[model samples]
Target chain A: MTGAPRRTIAIVGGGASGVILAAHLMKVSGGNVRASVIERDPRIGRGIAYSTELPEHRLNVAASRMSAFTEDPSHLLSWFRNKYPEARDEPGRFLQRREYGQYLADVFAAAAASASGSGGLVHIKAECASIVQVPGGLELRLSNGTSLASQIAILATGHDPGPHPDRGFASAGASVPPIDCDRRVVILGSGLSMIDAWLTLQARGHRGEIVAVSRRGLLPLPHGEHRNPIKLDRADIPFGTELSYFVRWFSDLIDEREAAGGDWRDVIDGIRPFNQQIWRDWPISAKRRFLSHAKAWWDVHRHRIAPDVHARAHEAIADGKLRLIAGKVSDIADRGNRTADLVVRLRRSGDRIALQDVSVLDCTGIIRDPATGSNPLISSLITAGMARTDPLRIGLDVTPDCAIVNFRGEPSDRLFAIGPLTRGTFFEIDAVPEIREQCQRLAVGLVG
Target chain B: MLTKKGKYGLKALVHLSRLPAGQLAFVGDIARANNIPKKFLDAILAELRNAGFVQSRKGKEGGYRLARSPSEIKVGHIVRVLDGPLAPIPCASRTRYEPCDDCDEATCQVRHMMLEVRHAIAEVLDNRSLAEMRDTTNDDLDLPQLQQA
Candidate 1:
């Protein structure tokens, strides 16, 4: 190891968050610190979402909003133009995800180049397997059986695949193979992920029927045209401590927005900037109190769908290619060769039990329960008492600055986290704006 | 659906895996055998070569061979080398964790929780090698587990 007094930082998981963080640190550090990216895969950037080769896999967000660095918001748009000049006419359009992945890779390449040319090395190791926090810093185990020692480490792990369902009946499910392409698939959730799965099945030429089941069966709201906008007057909305009161206020606000000719997406998007603050400022008891009753509705309102994607989903629904069922799954019986029969309980009806044959796909969104996380590092950290799960158990609890809090209610000096995993702490962590804000703040604190 | 690149790359790799060691297979042969576009497969091969997953011998009898033994190389390695990190989010990614500059990874609750996801993904990719992917199985009962899962 090179002996130097310089601070060496090791970053794990080279996804969007990691790459952006690295880029920001290099820009902000101005060659004072050394940063190394330890990626388990041989690829340095281009995480799963952007690595698609399908041109139809457009990003959910517009190209104008996907710059790697927050300060240079137009960077991605400019890059897009240079890469695909034919799409110059549409500025706010969702570009293909493959193009976005290339853009991110190019951004990281430039950052690494700048850091290297400046004599501040930005080492991007292709394979980092495990990391252990040490006395002075952190030690990362590489796939090649080597270890890198650094003073600080950041964990930017990316998205988790959906959860696996429990054991069920053999006869109840006979139409869908566990992962068959032609099976009558029953998607467990009705969100963006479910849309992706449905689209994927269609792309694969799977002609079988698709069923999306959720408790509410509430499909995502579509992005509306920027016509007659519904502007909410927050002045009249009385602040209330009770969950029912807040729900009543929100429902009324929704009604007003729709009446004003503005789509619900507009109302939700308009409130997003202040959403986290509202969650933070609200009494913790009230916030926890809302989880049981109002949270599901809140999620549907907040995470809207792309207009084109929504239209496609609606077309599928209208054509009967897709079915939306509002019910809780009671049991699933494996039939044979990727087929299953399921028992469903309607949420509204008291005693209506429906039995049907379908394939089940768990598109329940990224696994929220950190307790069920299959990562050894996280399990070790929790067992060693370095981190504590939040009251909701969706994720770990951290202090405002994002330091992981231990069971005794103390923040760890050595440990840190970021990204969608903080859903319990921050309601709006998945979007680009919040992530950019987060990357900026975290880089500053680390450099400072 | 896996991307065209991934699908083609996997097919090409599987085809390569079945061939005798050190024997060069032509790009045309790989493309024709797999029914992948010759032009697209060429580009993918170039990437695989540059990424050190494939070694090509350019000549009349030349095609491509595994840079490493089939058992040693992982499908994840080829995908990642040709593509990028397995996970998209910083928190779920196993290898690269540059804390978003705007937030403190140490103090950020979101990042902390994502660490679990990142490790889980990293563990799967890191543990599984190409050699494992090339092992052929006729067991129809073998649920082709998306090992990445």
Candidate 2:
């Protein structure tokens, strides 16, 4: 062990994906790699999703399937069992989001401790302001006025909290205090985040009527009893360049499954394993068509809610406590006294409905268009020509291995993007299972 | 969460639950009446029998019957026996309580929310016996309605 300098990798964003990559790197490299995780937040491991303290914000995926390591599928389950021996063995149970965050913290801590011999994992609690390619490697300008140079850098920044509505509502302003219970609340975009907002309101004992509006006004389907698992081969999917043919094939598959007394979820889950491959194979036009047409339908089915949560949501809808409207918010007017009036164009009729005196929460999922996002680092990278958006303007363009492609359309060997930032390259890369698998492979590739 | 096996098992049990006391129903009859595959129903009944929810008799009078009177058997027990647990998350299960790892049990909002769900489900499945469900005749177990007063 005379004098060889170990290769150092810098991970920006100490979120779930970032920590997972660090943990896997330490494990695979066996303390031979130097790792530094730079995060803006004081807490590492808890990303925007898992950082929530709200118990109502349960994991969308079941505990049995949420292991951090792909090799040890039951790692999380075992952790739960060891920690909470009395916790019942519910195969489909959705654990609290914070608990999962803690589990990740534990994993990171363990990996960091074991890798202490070889430079160890450095937890830099500072935001990376910009990343620039230097002669030997890359240098990261951190927000805390310190800079770090590494042989390689990874961007695991996760999702951006979408762009604000063009016409800002009064409640969208920073000065607006916590929403009062009696004030009518209107949530824009009916997706998982919208559901989280609803759950939050319900948990907070908000008594006002809640209205969630989206383009299609579709609520996620509730998770039912686990059915027989369906496996699909590449041949089973209508692999083609034509979007229409694929859509027809998918529709027929769902119909057949339903006719055969199988749930539509079986078909969706079966296709999930192949989503990225299919997305990669599609022509740009086909991809655009799917995004405009089928993305919403796919989202609601793919991201289902727990049955109990679904029952409460259904009850709320039935009781008129929650109203889901299929429409577009054409305009929002900020009235004085923390209230906003919104004009919603009904989807079916094209007629506009004026919703007066409501608090609007923008839960429109993630901001896919990186150019319009509020992240300074991402903006800086784009401006510096270090990173470029995909053709669809959804996310950063990268090769299959997630090496960020520069303005010149060449994949960078030293710069990598993981998690939601690489969504354009891997369609289903956001979830824990997908991200974990990607990190495992990425760690091996980096070290080897 | 009810598994497919649990759903099929419940459907078969409901068929048998509707039978008059001392009467027995064959797997084929239950399968045909419920639109469940015969082989599936057979396995479901075998599971029920093993779980002590039902008792089977062999020979010319071969069939299955609830171990206890249908009025005394709760849907929750059958579901728990077949489907695993009534909790959407394991932390909320009263019968099988395991504190979630890294969770603050006292303050966990998820567990708190799920506990309500577990109770809601138990209220319907545990409170309503097989006899009551069989007597309803509507076939659609109005669970959401059942939660209402």
DockQ (Cα-based) for each candidate: 0.01, 0.01
lDDT of 1 by residue, B21-101 (tens): 877789999999999999999999887775556789877777898765676555555555444445545544422334576
Summarize candidate 2's per-residue lDDT along B9-32 as a digit string, tens digits. Answer: 888888887778778888788889
> What stretches of model 2 exceed 4 Å from their correct place?
A1-5, A162-177, A335-339, B1-149
lDDT of 1 by residue, A367-429 (tens): 456765755555566786777778777677877677788879998665667776666777677
Per-residue lDDT value at A293 in model 2: 91
In order of appearance, the predictions have TM-scores of 0.67, 0.72
| Quality of model 1 by C-alpha lDDT | 0.67
* Every candidate's lDDT: 0.67, 0.81
TM-score on 0 to 1 scale for chain A of candidate 2: 0.95
